[model samples]
Target chain A: MMAEQISIFIENKEGRLAEVTAILRDAQVNIRALSLADTTDFGVLRLIVNDNDKATAALKKEGFTVGKTQVLAVEVTDEPGGLNKVLDPLCEQDVNVEYMYAFANPQCKNAIMIFRFDDIDKAKEILAQKDIKVIDGKELSGL
Target chain B: MPIFDIDFETMPREGLEAIQLRRLQTTLERIYATVPFYKETYDKAGIKPTDIKSLDDLRRLPFTTKQDLRDNYPYAMFAVPMEQIVRIHASSGTTGKPTVVGYTKRDIATWAELMARSMSAAGATNGDIIHNAWGYGLFTGGLGAHYGAERLGASVIPVSGGNTKRQITIMQDFKPTILCGTPSYILHLAEVADEMGVDFKDLYFKSGIFGAEPWTEEMRQELEAKCNLKAVDIYGLSEVIGPGVSIECVEEQKGLHVFEDHFIVEVVDPDTLEPLPYGEPGELVFTSITKEAFPVIRYRTKDITSLNPTPCTCGRTHVRMNKPTGRTDDMLIIRGVNVFPSQIESVLMETREVAPHYQLEVDRIDNLDTLTVKVEIDETSFSDDIKGLQAMEAKLSHDIKEHLGVSARVALVEPKTIERSQGKAVRVIDNRKL
Candidate 1:
């Protein structure tokens, strides 16, 4: 139910984002879904990657401040109201979503969304009750 | 240019030493008969006022330190009665209690005379208007310059620090010939004046007597270039008598002439406390021979500088002290505010999320000193949430500012990022040369 996400701390300078991606590419790590949160001075590059440990090690080796975060990958209906359908039940159960990003899975008619929640275990239990498919780390990475 | 006091300013060496000896004898006698702290210190050293037969024999006395002042607290070191004490000034003790100094009426007059001499040495005349930007209240810089300018018969604008734009407006309106403040503040004012489309060169500022903190010769060059005035370095400490202890003559910017008639200056090796030869850098020590209220005997200033015993080209026979290179203490003077690493460490220790690993970096950006605090985040408190980490940085910065009364940018680095030392950690990285 829990998925491992790699987060890299980067100074808000030109080419920093590209540098991180280059490091990942050189390490042969696939970035499945990504989001960037930035402020005036610095940015946090969050990635749902195919190889979390390998990507983190390579980024850290390149002197990037990197950390591993536990998130959730859920398969939702590839429809207009799919995100809202998955969010409505979690909101009702008082499960807070910190941040989320999505990517379309080509093999299935569904979208895979990576979610960081305040309580990942509570989020998994609520999603199970709602019958929404919560994908494992291996399945998500393979997709 | 008219000299402030012809008799003392151009005094011969023998005559100056005779005056220093007489005053030193009287000062020792007064301190021994009045302050118990000095009496105890002198008695413990098995020395008395009668034992001082010559100026060189004065080295037998025990050296007083900042901790000694703190132990005395407010008024324990005053050699005169409270009725005779006229004014009091203090150092901003960031680590502990403020070191206080009281002034008798005669001591105040002496301070004014020394400041007058300082202003005259820097080419300020009675007709010149002075804009004093040093802070007032208990701090000695503002009022010290104010009274000295007034004593020199110069009209003074008591615009004590801050309000950069307004200071420029006053400068434009008042047309003051002299500016008195820290060197950094004067440079900052020049930048603000430039931003306002007012050229400092066009202003009436002829000379600037900058002090209250250690500054470099490079900063002096920048200040002179930016302000279009002769930038003079004035050195003093509240423990001595404020900003007129020594002043650089405009004729020669080599070193500051110490007013030997009032204060005796010595340079000693900081490690061994042994007196260093002239022209060799060491810790500066001052013994106030003429101060009546709170005279310190062989007080350790912790400032690292040497003395030039040769006569100055300006014709002042008194000894000249070179600009201080650094301090013997861990104190960091940031933007004219005193900051200690222990204070920052204590503030960081108050928070559980931060590790004890920290470093203080002091740098100059645009002529103003900026302090940046780099601390390691504890492994348990580490989070990928950017907002949470930013909040922690903000909270730590706020705490430091609140406790230390100085603004510092707080940087949260990864744990073990700061290099650990085997013995003592290198806590401060000061990029500002002095």
Candidate 2:
């Protein structure tokens, strides 16, 4: 079970982030979860959107350097150390998390955490054997 | 100031033209007799050596271009036999094969004499120590300046290029009066010296003869202020005769005086190839009248500058050529390295994931030339992963540097972002001039 994340290459200049948001707003695309990794010269804006194809076309039409990456969404108990419980098993299995972000599902009591693992298949298999629920792209896109 | 070779340097216009005509006739006869390329060229033009009666008739001959030299390759253009050739030098072609030049014993002597004249005109004397920093080897800038300094009886340090710190150390210890190199490199040395806490002004440098690349007057001001010396512009090319074809007399910084007795200088319309009168800027073309090994007739230098036919206050009656303002070709001299846009385009074409659409942005950052290549990334290879994109950029940059010998900052822009023209694509956005 994997989710597609759209990443845009953004130059580190004034009002650049605003420009990206404005483009998305004009295209009527909703960004679900977003994260930015930046260096001195430029930054990469990683985004999970409601519609991948539409968002990619709209952004590409507006001349943005965009790419797609695969990530995993897992449901965790909304309790103390919920992230720790899910991370401990992957860490024990020697799986590395490149990056991660969280969002609470309104319909469920559990919290949905998105993870970009070094090896998505291996991490999914390990988490599956440990009885942790992995949210697929179809379900995550709906949220 | 002592005028070097008073007879030729101070010769009247009529006397200079008389010597030029005689030398031009001999040079034409030798090239037409020895080099088959010149024979075919002259035959195609329906002209003979005897047809060049006066200096003005020299224009009837076809202009020799750098492409002609490259097409001939190694020694096809040399008028003298291998036994008579003593030295060989070349200009870095950057595109393909280098344009080669050869020198016989007399040709070497002529080069030394012209260089000596250039040195003396720039206020260098026998007691002065010459620090030659223009590169050596196949490039004529180094050895050309070296022999001239020696010919002038000046102590030569032959400090070719690079090793910035050591060059400064030698400069401080040797206390040289004459510094010979490109103006940009001399400024670079000044910065390095300042960083080392060595005051360049305290050095015994009295004057500098800088050339091998075109530099602005502002650069001369910077070099003189930083190094505490008079920065004189010296012009030359390997195809004509390296580093001493012409030089600016220190007494008058107006324009460089071409050694008319040895070289016939002309400024012509780059498009029509029609000769322009004095004081009108055009493509500079040179004809080597006295060279023995490679006597070129109407060699197109591709440099854009005018000739000052007026008399100079320095007493040198030789026709003065203005410092070359630009080039007729798309050649860019970045930090003394010759870089062509076509060369950069070839590098980009070979690399994967980069589109053919690209623009080269050249800027002068902190008194140094900086090249930035803005290339478009193909949509198929575009990825959201930061590390993968960075790896691609690094690979392209490394490949470009390997091919061009000069480092460039590779900037990946979105496809169709670079303005596409219906006509010829404007490849170079030179911000350096601004």
Candidate 3:
């Protein structure tokens, strides 16, 4: 589950995203989903890809600094307060989420929210105790 | 680790005086024949080449100033013909018109010989590989050390400054036994090495020759600790011969050796231009004895130091100069007291809290000039407490005032706020409009 998401450091400059994607494409690593948090000089490029190891290696070889991170792919219903349900239990346990981004699967009618927290094991445990649906790497990569 | 010249290093007064007289005669004849500037100046001074028969008579010549060089500009100062000129290097053009200096092929050869002496003095030899990180081009430092390494028959890697990652990559790949550049740049490379998780200690860099800007003994200790190498200070100006005029030998970092064979040095009061007694701090002056193209006669260097004629333990006979305390040109006059940025650097390094990155913002608050030092705190020391940070700022401010006898506003900033420099770090930002 943790092997699918990769947190890469992309210097915030013009055409940086396109450059990273091009590097991934040339290496034949298919991206499942991607999001970015940016500041003036640099940004965090969070990616979920089919071959996380290959994409990481390819980008790194191309001189991009990359790091691995485990994130929860929580299943949310396609309705109001869907993200709220997935987030409340973690918030109660004080498992603060640094950031999150979403992707919708058209065929399943379900939204997958990728969550990054300071403590991954604690977050996973809280979600498990609450019986909240935490999708595996196969499910997250497919969506 | 600045060592005096091998040949001149242990010579007695009589022997040294003999060498100076011979070099002086040759220098005078060369300047008279090829350099129009020296010819005109000599005629006006009513001093003939024959008149300079000894070291005592050499002092009768007039002093040269930076203003004289600026007045002449480009090639007017060249004693040799343009056909023989090989390269030129210049001082940083911050104050006004840059002070231009020229070199001939012979001059370059002499520079390499002297730099080779500096390297050999630091225990670098033919079996070593030398990595030069000083910036190239009009600046004499990078190429100065580069030529010296080449002259010593060492494998030279002309890694001319910046791109720290690439510098380390080359450091690891090349496995150089010797490193040469500014002390500040080496410390910066150490930081990069740390970030890359490369154990620089395990690498092959055995020694370094660091100079070009004024740094303190404390800094020398810090750099030596970080880079895990014997760091030596080299002293020279573009007007004289670049970085290898004199250097520190391995015995101690006490003072720089003056290449008295090629250049004559004197410490004079910046105001009166009178020679200071040995061990009294004053402005440093130089007269190039061996330079063919640009032989500066008693040029006022503006750097401050004391002369040590006492023989060093290093077994060389060349006179040593204490590390320059400050530059008369760069000295800051605040409320009738003088301050140098190196003094502040010493204070900052002593603090042990702030990263080396800092800038002094000097401005007039009402009628008085105010100094505000903004020091960048290391990222690892970051915390979310605003009040505690303010306390740190106050403590720094108080401590600096207590140590330096000047009050300043100190502020702790986030890491990387201060600009990272590839060459000389700009520590002072004076907005006094003067």
lDDT (10s digit) by residue, model 1, range B1-434? 56799899899989999999999999999889999998898888888999999999977888999889988898999998899998998876645456899998999999999999999999999999999999887788889988999899999999998899999999998899999998888888889899999998789888999988888888889888888899899999889998899999999988999999999999998999988889999999999998999899899988899999987788888899999988888988876677889889888888877778899999988878899998865545556798998998899999988877679999876545566678666899988766
**Across residues B1-434, which tens digit of lDDT does each residue of candidate 2 receive?**
89769999999999889999998998889888899999998899899999988888977999999889988999999998899999998766746456789999999999999999999999998999999998887878899999998899999999998899999999989889999987777888888899999997789999999987788888888898999999899999889998899999999987999999999999999999999999999999999999998888898988999999889999999999998988888888776667788888888777757777888888877666788888877667676666777887788789877866677988776567677679566788888751
lDDT per residue for candidate 2 within A7-103, as digits (tens), equals 8877777898999888888888887778898765567888888888988898888888788889998899998998888999999989999888877
- In angstroms, the error of model 1 at B152 is 2.6
Residue runs of model 1 more than 4 Å from their true location after superposition: A1-72, A89-96, A103-107, A117-130, A135-143, B74-76, B80-88, B92-97, B420-424
- Best candidate, lDDT: 1
TM-score of each: 0.85, 0.91, 0.58
lDDT of 1 by residue, A1-143 (tens): 67888787766678879989999999999888899987776667789888888997897787666778888989989879989889999999898999988888867889988899998898999899889998888887887
| Candidate 1 collision pairs | none
Which one wins by TM-score: 1 or 2?
Answer: 2
Query: Model 2: DockQ against the native?
Result: 0.49
Decide which is better by lDDT, 1 or 2: 1
User: Candidates ranked by TM-score, best first?
Assistant: 2, 1, 3
